[model samples]
Target: MLPHYAAPIWLKGGGHLQTIYPKVLALPSVCYRRELLSDSTQETVVAYDFIDAPQTHAPVVVLFHGLEGSSHSHYALTLMHMVKQKQWHGVVVHYRGCGGVVNQSHKAYHSGDSLECEWMLQQLRQRYPEQKLYVMGVSLGGNMLAKYLGEAQNLALADAAAVISAPLDLPMASVALEKGLSKKLYAPYFLRSLLPKATQERHQGKHPHLHWDHLLASNGLKDFDQHYTAPVHGFDNADSYYRLSSAKPVLRHIQIPTLIINAQNDPFLPPEALPTAAEVSACVTLYQPDHGGHVGFVSGPFPGNLQWLPQTVLTFFSEHA
Candidate 1:
C-alpha cells in the first residue's frame, strides 16, 4: 500500500479511482439539479446542479469530468458530497455526448473545449447573480477549465478556480501515455470509454462521417485525436491540438486565484509535465507531490478516505472567497 505522504494533492485521470473506492462509492450520494441548456447551434447541454441545504450564499462549485465521465463518476459524486457537507452547491457539467442524452449538435467535447464552461457560468450568473461561482476540473476536464480561465481572465463568471491533476502540457502527457507498460494499461481504458460513444453517434446518424475501422485501428489518444478530433474541430493535426489546446500557454493569463495540483508519480503526467513554480502567475499556485498514482489518494486506515483534495479545495476556496 502507498504511504499517506506519497498521496499528492492532485491526480490527472479519473479512470482508476473508481476501482479503488468501489465500496465507499456505493454510499448514498446527493442528487444534483439537472438541466439541459441550448447553445447557439441549438444543442441541448446537460448540467447537474446540487444546491446546498438551507441555501447559504456559498460559491457554486462546478466539477468537470475527464473523458466519457458523468456526474455519477466516483470522484464527481464524492466531491459533490463534500460540497454539500460544506454548505455549498455542486454542479457537474456533462459534455455533449457524456450525459447519456445525445446533444442536438455534432460538436462533441474535447480537452480544450472551454466554450461550454463559459456558457454554463453565464447561465449560473443569470440565475444566482449574487452567488460566487468556481470550478474544479479533473484530468482532461482540468485542461479545459484552465484554458477557459486563461482565455477569459478578465471575465467575472468565476471568482476563483482549482484544477486537480491537469495536464498543462498535452504533448508530454501523450508521450507519457505511450511509454512501455503505461501504454498497455492506459490506452485501452480511454479507448473503451471514448470509442463506443462515437460508434453510438454514428449509429444514430449524428456523426455519420466517423469511421469505426479507422477508430479501432488507432493506437493511442493522440492517434484518435489526429484522425477524429482535429479534423472535425478544424485543427491542422494532433500536434496542433496538443499545442493550441494545452493549458500551459494560458496559465500565465489567468487573473483569478487558481490552484493546480500535479503529482510526480501520476501515470498520465510525467515529472516534466508538471509546471514549474516560476511558470505560474501571481494568482496561480502549483502544488507538486512525490506520488498520487493518477488521482488515487487514499487517506487514513479504517476508511482510508479520499478527503485531502476535497478538503484542500474547500479551504482554498474559503480563504480566497
Candidate 2:
C-alpha cells in the first residue's frame, strides 16, 4: 500500500517552493568514504560509501544522483543519514563527468545510459554477495534506472528498485522545462555545468565539427542537446535524442518489483506523459502522489526538513507484508 502524503500548510505554495525548499534546509552531512571506480569502458566514476553504515551484513542501498548531482547532494546526504539510522549500508554512485570531476570519455551521461547502471550495481553486488541490495535513482538518474530495469528485464541487479522524480518521457519533460517558470529557474542551473563541461571538452579538441557558435550561445537544454549532446553522443538532433532516450516506451518489459514515484505537482514533468496501470508490467508499481515537488518532499513546522522523500522510499523498501 502507498503511504498517503499531505503537503503541510506552511510548506504549501506549490511545486516551486517545495522543490526549492530542500536546498535551504540543514540536511545531515554524511561522512562518506569516496571510492573511485571504473566502468567496463574503463572510464572513471565516483561512488561515496556511508562510512558509518555496517557493511558486513546489512542491506546496501545504492543511489544514483540526478543530473549534475553528486554524492554530496542534499538528497544523497539525507537518504544516507536515514540508512545509517537503520544500520544499513548506503552508496551514492556519481554519473560519469559528475562529482566535480570531468570523466575521461568523450560522452557525458544521459537519461538512457543503462550500461553504466548495470556495471556499477553488478560491481557492488559482487562485493556484497550475501547481503540484500536495493537501488533508487533520482530525477535524471531515476530515468536511467527505469530504462535499465526495462532493458535488463529480470537480470536482478538489485532486489527491488524505486525511482523518484524521473522524467520517463524525455521529450515531454524537456517540453515541461520550457514552461514559463521552469524555463527561468532550471535552465540556468543545468546550463551552468553543461556549458562549462562542453567548453572543457572543446578545449580538448572534442566536437570540433559541432556548431561552435550556436553551442556556445545555447539558451536552454534543448539548444544544448541539439548543438552538443546529440552530436557528441551520436544522435541526429535534439528530437531524436529525446525520443530514443525516454524510458516510457519500455515500462511493460520490466520484470522486477519497481516503484516509480512521480509527484503530480512536479513542474519538471508533464502529467500527460505519466503512465497508467495498463502501460506497465504487474511488478511495476506507480506511486503518483498529489504533492512533493520535483524530488522535493518537505513537511513540518517553521523550518521544514526533507524526510518525506527518503522516508517514503525506505518505507516502500522495508514493507514485506
Candidate 3:
C-alpha cells in the first residue's frame, strides 16, 4: 500500500508555513548519553549521542542530521523521542565539527561524504551484534545515507533505511535554493551558521592555500561550495561535486529495502528534479506527499503535531525489520 499523508486543513497549501512551523514550536526534552568516536584521520573526533531504550535487546536506529545540523536539531530530537517511545535504541551521528566541538582537521562534512556514515554503521554493528539496526537521514544527511546504501550494496550495514527531504539532485536543488524567495529566506540563514564555522576552521590553518578573503566574500551556498567545499573536498568544481555526490544516479544500485520520502512542496528541490520509477532500484520505495515542506511533515490541527515524520519513518523501518 502507498503511504498517504493528509496535511491539516489549516496547514495545507503553504510550503513556507509547513517548513517553519515546527522550528518555532517546542517539543519535549530528551536526554542522551554522549559518545565521542575518533575519526580515521586521527586528528578529529565526531560525537554520537545515544538514547537507549528500556528493554535490553531493543532494535537500534542510527540517525543522520542535515547540513550544519546536530543531535539537538528539531527533527533529530523529535525522532529520538519517538524512538524512545517505541522502546528502541537511537543514536544521532554528529558530523565532524558539528558536535559542539571544532574538529582538529580542516575537512568538514558534506552531503556526499559517506565514508563517515559507513564507518559509524560498521562500528555500531560490531558493538551491538545482537540487535537489529536501521538508519534514517534528513536532507543533506539523507543524501549521504542514500549514497552509502547504493555504494555499499552487498554489505549488511543496516536492516533497512529511510531518507527524508533529501536533495537527491544536488545541482537542481542548489539552483532551487539560490533563486527567488528561497534565496531571500533560506540562504541567509544557512550562511549565518556556515560562514562563521568556515572562517573559524580556516583561521586555525585548516586551508592555508585558499585565500581567506575570497572565501569570506561568499554570501550563499553556491559561492561557498565553489570556493571552499569543492577545493577542500578534492572536487574539480562545484558542478562536478554535485554530479558525483548526487544520490539520484546511484539509487538504482541499492540492494536493501529503502524508503525515500520527499514533499512536493519542498522549498529546496524542484518537483521536476525528482526521480522517476526508472531511476531507483526495485527495493527502493518513493513516497512523495503533496505537502511536507523540506524536513517538515507537520500534521494535526492548529499549532500542529510533531509526530508525523517520526511515525512515518518508524513504520517503514518496522515493516522492513
User: Per-candidate RMSD vs. true structure?
Assistant: 4.0, 1.6, 1.2
Candidate 2 displacement at residue 218 in angstroms: 0.8
Tell me how candidate 3 scores on lDDT.
0.87
Q: Candidate 1, overall lDDT?
A: 0.74
Sort the predicted structures by TM-score, highest score first: 3, 2, 1
The best candidate in terms of TM-score: 3
- Supply every candidate's count of residue pairs whose N, Cα or C atoms clash at under 3 angstroms: 1, 0, 0
Candidate 3 lDDT by residue in tens digits, 1-321: 534787888887677778878898778689999988877566788898999888868999999999888888889989999999899999998888886977887677889988978888888998779898999989999999999999998684988999999999999999998888888888788888888988888777688877678778986788888888898888988888999999898899999989999989999998899887889999999999888898888878778877888888899988977
lDDT of each: 0.74, 0.85, 0.87
Cα lDDT, model 2, residue 275: 85
Whole-model lDDT, candidate 2? 0.85
Whose TM-score is higher: candidate 1's or candidate 3's? 3
Instruction: After superposing candidate 1 on the true structure, give the runs of residues whose Cα lies further than 4 Å from its correct spot.
Output: 1-28, 206-212
Estimate, for each residue in 168-213, the C-alpha lDDT of model 1 and write its tens digit: 7999988887887678777887788777776776777764565557
Among all windows of ten consecutive residues in candidate 1, which has the lowest summed lDDT? 1-10
